[model samples]
Target: MPRLLTRVKSKMSIFAHRKARGMLDGEYGSVFKGRSLDFEDLRAYIPGDEVRDIDWKASARHGSPLIKRYVAVRRQTVLLITDTGRNMAASSLGGEEKKDVAVMALGVVGYLAQRHGDVVGMVCGDGTASRSWPAKAGEAHLERLLRDVNDGTALTSPRSSIVEQLSYVARNYGQRMLLFVVADEVVPDAGMERLLRRLRAQHEILWLTVRDAQLAGPGVPGSANSGPEDRYDVADTRFLPGRLAASEAVIRAYAAAQEQRDGGREAALRRLGIAHVHAGSSHDVVPAVFTLMERHRRGK
Candidate 1:
């Protein structure tokens, strides 16, 4: 587990440098602008400075507009909310387990937080049972948190709902936190959407959806196999009848349904002001996370 975390950190280091440069150049956006928790100093108002941050008394005394500058809080909390359901145990097209991809994703975020001096925590569950680690700083604590979740010792049930973890955080974890939710390709349904909305209202939410190639439609270009003889099931391993898989009309309908489901999930997240990225395999996790961060920084 430590070795995997080290590799993920090495890869993320390059991306982190790029992101830091982007933030300084105003290329990324306001994603990291207002997270400070301590007042640093006052300065003459800049054109792009948020008006709400103006120090009224200081401005009056100086006879010019001034802005309150706050130092970036180094001890903020980063929470990894992961789903350990059976679906997440499925294999990806890259031949790596979805669970492994999730761990890699977690490591990328965890390492970044550690570098920023942020306390890292996790809430891992299988719907029926869940385990949570309080926010803590240090590499060793972070490694233990990751190992515990990756080992599946904390997941008490095979059937887990990501919504359950979201609800748990919303109810119990009150501090404003940066939350990274790692889960399988299940789209948000009405119930899940409601839970996510509540959670987003209180925390910064970033979602990573690990894609399952099997969910690709028959007509999808570059899909694993669209051939008539190809056999595939949903990410959850739900089988479609042989006739359905072979029928052109049924294949088209299935593809359309999946598209609609995916679209709805994206729309819901956007409406709730949550950022999300999709990863197709373990190899895609790090890049996808970087992309997600860039988009959020750009306020996309």
Candidate 2:
């Protein structure tokens, strides 16, 4: 496959001109400001910065307020978390493969972390297996991580299990780091809630959910608003009869169930102080990331 990170940066350059690009770095920096240690330097304060971080004596000497930068904040380990399985190989709500969207989203955040002077790593797996890579600096390392996500995910892969990956990190890793998670729509459960509470106590978490293709409606499962009549299921490799999902009542029920699923996930994450966002396709990743970091920085 072509270089995945190259595609990611090109899109970043395009998004850079769109206003949100420049703000991403500052937003990212602000998110970790509270975790900083050992004073490094100072920069002009922005509106949203916490008042406690300002150096009043320094501000008296200088014309404007300056925010203290810290060594720990400048060299954070950003752990990339994702689910690579049959679920990811399926199509997204934007009519593209979920794996492709995941790669893009992961690459975007990884690139941002790299630019912010942080090391990027990954933890991903299916229901039965999990894998991880150490955090390291450089575009080359970030490229390899993105490539792993792109190449490993397939329709024939094992079932997706983000919980198992979280468990893996909880069991082994002790460092407090930022966890940028990319996964498909997940319904909240008691076990999941327990696991998230545990992880939040150890690491900061950000979740991005790739919107699954909508079935049981007029549109195709993966397509945004249009597609063939039938929906395909990867697990059993069976085609869903269009007549079954074509009913109006069936469509309403499916939509309601999906909403509940979304709300459940949102509430669970919020209760644990984790920030979550939704990306329907590649087009949504950039803005979704911006919104995620904003919420994180503002504690919303």
Tell me the deviation in Å of residue 232 in model 1. Answer: 7.2
On lDDT, the candidate that comes out on top is 2
Candidate 1, residues 1-300, lDDT tens digits: the string is: 246677666766666565554342232223456864689999999898899999999999999999988887657788999987766766565656677788888987887777667788999887676779998888788777777766773223377588878888877988888898998766777888888888877777888887764533342334464554444443344656555676778768767887887898789888878888888776687678777887777666
lDDT of 2 by residue, 1-300 (tens): 679998888877777899844687888887786674678899999999889999988988998999987676458989999999888998888878998899999999999999889999999988888999999999999988988888899988998888889889998789889999898888769998998898888788889999988777777543454533778876457787777678888889999998899888888888888888999889888889989999998787
Task: Please give the lDDT score for candidate 1.
Answer: 0.73
Score candidate 1 by TM-score against the native.
0.81
Off by over 4 Å in 2: 39-73, 221-228, 235-238
Clashes of 2: 2
Model 2 TM-score (2 dp)? 0.86
RMSD values, in order shown = 4.2, 4.8
